[model samples]
Target: MDDEPIWDVDRVVALTPSSAITIPETTNEFVIKGNHLTLIKGNQLDGRTKTDPHKHIHEFLRICDMFKYRDTKNEVVRLMMFPWSLTGEAKTWLDELNEGTIDTWDEL
Candidate 1:
């Protein structure tokens, strides 16, 4: 059995690539607060129904605006935090993109 293939399934599994969005370097002292994550999670976009993508983005920006860090730009923060607000198929789609494909928020 050690040499046998199980159900003809491939031995190798495809992995999700690293995100193309570059997160800016931050000082060791910089920390994203729990409330910030909470806010973003609260307004998650699951890619269903009549949810307005533009409106969702605006709300996401508003949440990102609530926090500031001296070591990193606000745009960097938005890029780092945006992925936390997706669920289901939306998340799957993002995870499937090739690494280094998106270098900026505008590209995303």
Candidate 2:
């Protein structure tokens, strides 16, 4: 309609975090195994009914525990893998968080 204002995507800035998760350096190669990724992807959270957030968190932690990297803290692995465990609204919520707001697992 003539009365409606046009939306400008170029003028809009993406509010991406400067450092959502700070991954600690590791002496050994830090790689997310396909099996682990597959498992986490299988248990993704969509922030919808019928999906238990608490359960997802617990399961995520459990999967993270199965992975280990020298000089890399467990929390670092958790932080790196947490994003993969989300989808739909859950992923959208994480993406919309303020810049540099989350730098630690506790903060996340």
Candidate 3:
């Protein structure tokens, strides 16, 4: 078998709450209520530089996709918090994101 990470049921359930999934474009600011996540027009959020709301939303969507696919919750969380530590399946998802293969909120 290939050395790719395969998602399983346990991982999906475990990582569902670590972050919010990106909701389809509906507003111009970041929105996170209950399990609904949205993003609006803006570049600066919580005083973080080079942090675009749209990009953040996309990242969340990617993470959500990883979770949906069964990537380990802990590894997914680590990738979001510390990308430098990316390895195994987490790295695969990151690569997919970079390659624009992961589906966007609208696509989902």
Candidate 4:
């Protein structure tokens, strides 16, 4: 998810300019595997990051939430957080945002 400020799910993205998703403060750790995301909050957050080598998994998780939406098929998995639930459509445009890069972020 670029791991930059622009990777944000609210004020960071261009789409839904006026819309901002409110994530709970308890949130400190999150991730995106394919299209699905898993969030683990609480005091254990700091512990979560230390274990994962990925620079900004949380950003990816949040970005997934921002770009995530229901597809034409209306599969509940399309907009939910399950390992194989995501469509991978949002991450496709970046060519490599999940890899943590946004060289041309203006189009977001």
Candidate 5:
């Protein structure tokens, strides 16, 4: 399933790879995949947090999970959960891509 993106201010937050973002307080499970953030609510048993009042609770990211990206295709791509520490060469690669100095991914 897919949901269309709306690039409005209230919808997304600009982010960099180094940005530190918090997952929800109650959730023990968190997921970050290609342009998606998913949180699985738990049963508090004490009736503190509702299991899920909505049907599609895990279907989309909350407002906090949304982030901005810089892509030419405008196809949303997200950082992987276990991000590999990038080398300094990544910046040079980004510079080349941004400046249109590289013609192919092999140059990266």
Candidate 6:
């Protein structure tokens, strides 16, 4: 079976409790229960915390099962993994991406 695309918040919340979800665009930690998503403060979610964006990216990569395929050669992954490297406008664009406010990647 083909893997389901996790392209939005709803899809992410659909994951089982044991599954970990990451939102590369924001600093808020998320917890889901029966389609309801709660945003937690800081990098820790349920006692799991990341010290920095770099560590968070590592955690995200593990959750997404993308570690083997991730590299600097892929620009999108690079950007998502190192959000601290982005400019203010780029950060805003990523926020819009998370909110589903932008229609296309080109809009960033």
Residue pairs with backbone atoms closer than 3 Å in model 5 (clashes): none
- In candidate 4, stretches whose alpha carbon ends up further than 4 angstroms from where it belongs are 1-55, 71-108
RMSD of 6: 16.9
Tens-digit per-residue lDDT, 1-108, candidate 2: 422222222444466755355665566776778888898899898877667788899999988898776677888778888889988867866776666667778887
TM-score, cand. 4 vs. native: 0.18
Model 1: per-residue Cα lDDT over 63-102, one tens digit each: 8998887767787788888889887646655666667667
What's the C-alpha lDDT at position 38 in model 2?
92
Tens-place lDDT per residue, model 4, 13-100, is 3333221222223223333343334331210122121233233345434544454333312122222232222123322223323332
Q: Which of 4 and 5 is the better model by TM-score?
A: 4
Clash number by candidate, in order: 0, 0, 4, 0, 0, 0
Per-candidate Cα lDDT values, in order, are: 0.74, 0.74, 0.34, 0.29, 0.26, 0.32
Model 1 regions lying over 4 Å from their true place? 1-15, 27-29
Candidate 6 residues 10-65, lDDT tens each? 43222132212132343343322221111111222221122244554455444434
Scored by lDDT, model 1 comes in at: 0.74
Could you tell me which 10 consecutive residues in candidate 5 have the lowest summed lDDT?
39-48
Which candidate number would show the highest TM-score if scored against the true structure? 1
In model 2, the Cα lDDT at residue 28 comes to 70
With a 3 Å backbone cut-off (N, CA, C), the pairs that clash in candidate 2 are none
Residue 103 of model 5, lDDT score = 34
Question: 6-89, model 3: which lDDT tens digit per residue?
Answer: 443143222232223232333234222323222121211221332343665465545444432222333333233332223445
Candidate 6 residue runs with Cα over 4 Å from true position: 1-50, 66-93, 96-108
C-alpha RMSD values across all candidates? 9.5, 7.6, 16.6, 14.5, 18.8, 16.9
**Candidate 5, which segments miss by more than 4 Å at Cα?**
1-89, 96-98
TM-score of each: 0.77, 0.74, 0.21, 0.18, 0.17, 0.21
